[model samples]
Target chain A: MTIGSQVKQSLANMKAIHATLQQLALTSTNEEAQRAFHEAMLETEQMIAALKGRISTLEREEPQYKGM
Target chain B: MPAWLEVAIRSICILIGLFIITKLLGKKQLSKLSFFEYIVGITIGDIAGTMSMDLDIRLTEGVTSILIWALFPVAISHISLRSKKFRDFVEGNSTVFIKNGKILEDNLKKEKYTADELLEQLRKKDVFRVADVEFATLEANGDLSILLKRDKQPLTIGDIKPYVPEEKEPQTVIMDGKILDEPLATARLNRGWLKQQLDQMGVAIENVFLAQVDSYGQLTVDLYDDRIQLPEPQQKQLLLASMKKAEADFELFSLQTNDAEAKQMYEQQAKHMQQLIQKLQPFLM
Candidate 1:
């Protein structure tokens, strides 16, 4: 697959992980677990944002990859 | 020397010799002994027992026999380690009795194991149905190692992918009313912290029979007085519940709001909070 598609796939995986972490945080009864999950989710969100930015940059530089 | 005195001296000498020989033999003798080791152990024990009571056998001769018996096995084991063929000869090869859920009658006959005996062994392993067994082997030590079919296998933690926090062993800070300083240090806690915790609970350190600190730094104490019921720790649970309530409120705010920007912000916060809760589920739960 192209670099764009690979990056998109990674981005998708990160989002899924973030969603799972969020779900765990909501469902967890332990305070420590909830805190840990919330912290991890925030970190994952930052990574997702970073990936999104990279995708935008890639699309701008290579117009052919845009909307792929 | 009196005959009784001579007998006492001989028994003491034999006891020391037996202790030294057992020490040289290593811990394997204490655990599952191979067939060869079992026979060697029995022979040495019988010789020691005879040498202890019987005044006829000289101490020197008995000691020499025990030494040879003990050292020969040690030498054989060392040699077996270097040679696979020798190892197989000394520790007999394990026989496969069942393959692909079918018992091999020929192998069973070769091992002189009856169909009834195989079923009995299988039953001992909690495998009632022979058809459920995918692979079964009779170990050299007479242990039946059985592997169930894929469908019959129990589900493990690996089957479901979830974030599980690594837990450190609970440190026993107090045992029998005495504070263990080393364990407290290992748990990264000091006496002041422990004192404060005890004081908060209104439990005297002397009254506590056992106290353990878990990975979450929650101190659990058992008092000598069984009638006194200490409240269970619920701080973490309460905090998690409050966080969930906040997340719910955010969702409600997002739904009730008319302003597009305000609604979007509230929705984003709710989503973020939800993700945070999901991440903490394993540890908190």
Candidate 2:
């Protein structure tokens, strides 16, 4: 698979993981468990955001890539 | 046991090997490298670094790893160049975020870009208003390519100037005292005509440094000695005739065009050309 597609797939995976973590954070009775899940979800969201930025960067460079 | 000497020799070998491999790879700058290539470069550098300093690993083992890392990227790059599918897989496709002054919401969502970010990008392109953009694409390299709407685009010489001269490409007839046959043919002139021109300028073909014929069939010759000065002749009649033809064409366009804006533009052009002709009348006399 292309690096771009892999990054996109990773982004999707991260989003799914983030949604699950959010749900877990809400359902957890223990305050510590809830906080940890929330933190993990935030980190996953950040990763997804970074992946989106990477995809945009790759898309922008395509014309030069074609010339190469 | 002089283990230090062996380590030093191994380090030198690794350095030389990495240098040669790097030179073998084409001179694509780090900034120009795609994400995959960038990762490959880092991996290769890491392998080289491990080989250079680590005494625990066998020198041959490290060198082999380095070669594999470097050659794999080169091979992939070759394959990518040969296959469009491979290239597309390696580099994602660019998406159009805006088309015909309308924001492509679906595409924006797919790209995970917010409408506010799109507006910011448009602003960076000097497009203050979204309505002014005809098309805006988010390229794979993260660049925003924008085309302004027709009416919003900056005016060119053709928009205001009455006379739009015919587009003609210049042809080189001679270079370094040697007459190029292909350019001469492209210019639709023979050696005889070239020789005649050279004779008119009192220059021999062997002494001519460069000679080019412009679209208007005007010849400019430069000599190797740089002593000769060629006088440029101004033809008042040619200019007057072209002006008159342009005035007539604009008047004709104004009559035939049904588009209000185009008709108005043509009328204004005709008026401008008429004024130009009047100003040139004294010069013609």
Top candidate when judged by lDDT against the true structure: 1
| Residue-level error in angstroms, candidate 1, position B101 | 0.9
Once superposed on the true structure, which residue ranges of model 1 sit more than 4 Å away at CA? A1-68, B160-168, B253-263
lDDT of 2 by residue, B1-285 (tens): 477887788778778877788887878625644767777788888887776677788877877788788888788888988999998887767899888788899999998999889888988878889989989898876788999999999999678766543435778999999989998777666798789868987889999888887544457888888777776633335445644665675576568646576567657756765765664443332
- Predict model 1's lDDT versus the native: 0.80
Worst 10 residues of 2 chain B by lDDT: B276-285
Looking at model 1 chain B, report the run of 10 residues with the lowest lDDT sum: B234-243
Candidate 2 local lDDT, residue B40: 78
DockQ of each: 0.06, 0.00
TM-score of 2: 0.43
Model 1 agreement with the true structure over B176-209: per-residue lDDT tens digits? 9999999888767789889998999999999999
Top model number, TM-score: 1
